[model samples]
Target: MVLRFLFLFLVLLYSAKVNSQLLTDELARLNNLGAVFDDLNNDLKQAKKTKSISQTTMAHYNLAIFCSNHRVYTEALHQYNNTINLLEEKKNDTLYAKVLNQVGSIHLELRNYNYAKDYFIRSEKAAELIRDSVLLALATSNLGSCFEKQKKYKEALEYQNKSLQIFYKLNNDSGLAIVNESIGSIYEDLENYKLAELYFKKALKYNKNEKNSRLASIYNNLGDTYRKTNRLNIGLDYTNKALSTAVEIKNTLEVASAYKDISKSYNLIGDYKNAYTFLQSFLKVDTENKRLQSANQSNALQHIYNSKEKESQIQYLLQLNKANKSQKLVLVVLVFMVVVFGVVWYLYTLKKRRHISKELDFKQRILKIELDKKQAEEKNLQKQLHIKTASLSRYSLHLSQKNKMLSNLSLTLKNSLQRNNVDLKRKLTELIKEIDFNLAQEKEWDEFMAFFKEIHPNFINKISNAVTSKLSPAELRLCILLKLNLSSKEIASILRLTPDSVRVARYRLRKKLPIDSKEELSLYLMSF
Candidate 1:
């Protein structure tokens, strides 16, 4: 018992070790695939920057195919849409048809039948336009699958037959195998077990060289057909084979389908215990598949929402850019108008200032001419006053000499009469009295004074107001001579008096005037 228990423990440990190794190998393989995908993505970005649109489109299509095969359906759909958009812009019908077919397959997997049909139809049209036989075959096969999903077996068969003929013409063994499998699935849905078996066998023969998930699917279909026909042992063998292939390829959906078929076969053969065990296994795998499917669906929805948001943002930015350009145009026009107005105003002010400056210069020249004329008239008047003053001085000197000669002649006559006769003494006395009367007369003095007043208009009145007493006529005559800058001898000669008598009269005049002892009387009088 101890040895048996130890053996069982050893077996269990070996099984666990194998499972761990399998898991580790699977993880390493997936990591390597992810690294390859990253490299491809980098190459795609570089191609876009270089504006190699053809290379960019090819890279995106390749990545989409890779993701689709790996069951990364959301990423696969996104990449496929990107490829389609690029191909459309380039008008590359062949490539565009290929991408549309792949996109339809993805929508069919998601159970979006309407979307799948639309894409498939569009792809078929594009392929037909470009005469691409391989692409048209693929698109027709996918459209048949869509019809099969909808339970329209007649329509599905029609499209499948069309695809099969094209595949034959092109010698595409893989495409022929795919179409055969789709037709077999539609027959199975119609409950025609014999016909389904026949097509499944043909698909298996064609798929023999293709070591892929599609081979596992054909195996699963074959297992289902045999089970429906009551071939229990054959059905179990085929179902187990399908499970093995699915595990090797890591195709979870196919694996679950194989498990379900195995469980059904066991139940039909009266192996209730084994059937229950297989059913539990099927349930576990199916649950895990549903969980993964749910996650993929959620990711796909999120991707669609994000794409719509990006399109909205692009439209908003375009409108804003247009508004900015319009505002800039208006601003430029306003600035131009302001500059033109400023230039016009500056030119007007400059012209006005020039006219004002010319007018000012003309007025200045006229004033200068008037001032010169007044100066000339004043000079002539001064010359006339100087001549008149000189004439008055000469006349005063002549009167002084005539009075001295007359007095001397009268004295000589009086002396001769006294020596000759007493009778002649009375006549000589009368003659002396007549000569004195003529000498005392003021006719010449009056003429000289009148001439002085003409030249020195305010001289007499100004001197009288300045003196303390009123001036006699003799003093007035003396004051006028002093104002003319005359010497005391010249003044005495003009007055017909001796120089001593003239000095004595000036001293008396000085006492009556407001003059200091240090001031010359003639100079003081001339100041007036």
Candidate 2:
């Protein structure tokens, strides 16, 4: 009877421990949700004030997510690093895994595929150690996504299958649905439209609540698969479903993405009017999202607050100084009257007034100098910012152009692969090589000449036509390299030519351009 009572007591204790763990889990979820909402509201100040390490870690993680969604990658990376450090310090293995997953996602968005893969692998390792089925599933799915992006369909399928198995064992319906959709996406990529559609439909059947964004994504995927199979009406139907679901959920970002998909579908079907309509909607939504994000940053409000606070402090100091000076003047006048009577006091007062005047003049001069120095510093900072902004903008624009060109080149390369046409493959390779060359020398003499023409529009056509005849593209490239003070070997390496060829090109350029026999090309090029 006593043994039976002890068994009952042990059972009760075990039950209580389970209940406590459950409470802790619920609290953690609540904290994470609160942090996410705070980040969404741009309440960073309040988030930092929470004092809980978990809360701060979650807040930083959420802010990273927010920044990444808005394409502010540097800021996202900053927040992600902070979150990682905090989570690591706490030794919160589960949260650490989750944060690593988020970091991987950001790196994926940044196109740092290798780094993304590394982070995902680390996340999977943590999840495996913890035996956290949900996180393990998440890590597997994310790793699958990275492989899919790299076009490793077989590997992607393996990872996705593994994730699906885990999700099924855990009865994680949402995860199962997502893995199915991902599998379908890979099938579509492999050009197995029927198989893709089958998987997508399978996922849809389990998507009862329509609460998951994966549902909308799968609908869009099905639409794309149908479009590929030349089923325009079916594609339109699925795209419309996606649009409806996205809108119903008030997922503005997803809504914009849906509109973009719809536009592409219509474009594929040659329905220009419908395509244009959706395109306009997509643009409008995107612009509104950007504007909303900028507004949330509150840069202007913070600047104004900082300025007002500084001005108030300066005013308070000025008032204090004036009071101190007045008291000193009164004390001095009293002392002078006691020591030497009214005449001496009057003389001392005159002398003191003159000394004060001189001191005031000196202070004014010093203020002027300080003001001038501050103005100069402000101008320098503005100049530096302008240069940095311009450089960043140029880099961004260049990368965009390169991406477009690379996409075209990839399509061309794929076509060559399909046809098994050696000549076509060689030509495509040459084209790709030319693009790489152009990218490498994008800011060469040709670009400078173009820029020069922009500054001097009247002579543009004449100068351009003249320059074209005198300088072949290779010669122009060599000239630019030379102007940059690069050696012949460096120029050759850049242009994939021999040093002897570069020298020949330089000789030709000197003959073509207005350089004298004794003139240094580098000096002349930099003169402008």
Candidate 3:
């Protein structure tokens, strides 16, 4: 009986180990797949050469993401449509549903609010069908954002709350961080800067020491909050950080927004030069966006107006025709009294009404012609917006790729340790610890650069020399790592250094830079 019990325990242990190994392997593959997706154009080329359906689907999805990033809505839409077709054949409903959400997101980014809402609703349905809480939460969160953009404050808050509840239940830290940020944005829009700041700070705490593009947005909101509270200096400081982060992430739109916020702060303080500088930046971003969408919306509006105007004219003309028919009948009835002066007056009035009707008909034709012109313009604008949205989506993907390297390292380390491979375990543990440490604080940027320089000496020198900022190789490495939001431990592992050594390097990097002691070194590096 004792032998039987021991055998059962061993079997269970082995089963558990196998399961863990499988999960880790799957995760690693997924991570690498995601990294490959970052360079979709190249991947597609390779996939075409291999004729792999999975690769094809992946390529299509990657292309869709790229299109979405660049604001190429139609192209993105096409890619997604093709991907769905491929996914359908493979019977991968889970991924299909996720793609639906992506489509919804693209629509939302394009400002097609109703279309966006429809897509999100469909995505939520798909998630429900698949019983995927993560997908459900993501769909709900997207709906909340859509409502927020539409200025449906109460509805937006409710959606956000729903998403937050799901994220909490799922114990998804990243989702929770996003929810916190969304909540903060709603408060900011409602003019409750205090509450907004509270939420922003919560999100910041959650996302600390990471290269999260969302953090830049939160920073921008925090700056706005500070400005609203009449803390101009604080506002400027935060805005600068936000701007720096946006630049690091290559998020032109957010960078433009940050500049506008800074300009507003400067304007409030009567610093015209700074304000003007920011305004120019704002204008550049705004003009480009407006050039893409304004004409389309205007043309659409004009077409609708003109169509209505023509319809109204037609109704009036019909009424005039009816009146003329009645007049003709009266004239015929009065034919016997043609010699009477009153009959002459009646005929003259009928002729005058006919002339007026002819002029009105002419105007209606002109209006219809104008409407056609407006419709054409609207199409052009839509095309431009599609292009821009697609462009932006690519940048977002790039950000994701850069951050995934650290995650991969962590996963690899964890796997090696479990395998009981002593050398591999030690190496992975060291790496995991290093990443964790870099992420432990907000000022590990300098340390990250030093590590980066050690890995890519040539690239660091090139980038450094190209820029006016004389950041040392170490500082530059730190800057790139900071952009990725690596934990100190992760940085150390990548650089093959002790945790203490990593800390000392970070200290030296900070001391070498010209920044306030309290300011985050990553934020400082981004400013350049």
Clashes of 1: 0
Q: What lDDT is obtained when candidate 2 is compared to the true structure?
A: 0.71
TM-scores of the models, in the given order?
0.52, 0.46, 0.44
Predicted structure 2: clash tally: 0
Per-residue lDDT for 280 in model 3?
A: 78
Winner on TM-score (1 vs 2): 1
lDDT of 2 by residue, 374-403 (tens): 999999988977775465435434544555
Q: What local lDDT score does residue 53 receive in model 2, on the 0 to 100 scale?
A: 74
Error of 2 at 436 (Å): 99
Q: lDDT of each model, Cα atoms only?
A: 0.80, 0.71, 0.73
Per-residue lDDT of 390 in model 2: 62
Residue-wise C-alpha lDDT for candidate 3, range 1-528, written one tens digit per residue: 586346434533543354345345534544454344346656776887899988988898877875565455776798899898888764437888899899988888779989988978888987888889999999999999999999999999999999999988998878888989999999999989888999898888777777668878888888989999999889887887887776666555676688789889989988787688668767765664454345433433344345447658988999999999999999887775766657777898899899889989999999999999899999988886666545433433433344456657667767768886788778778888987665444344354345444444565445465554577665665556554456676666545557798788788777665668999876666444
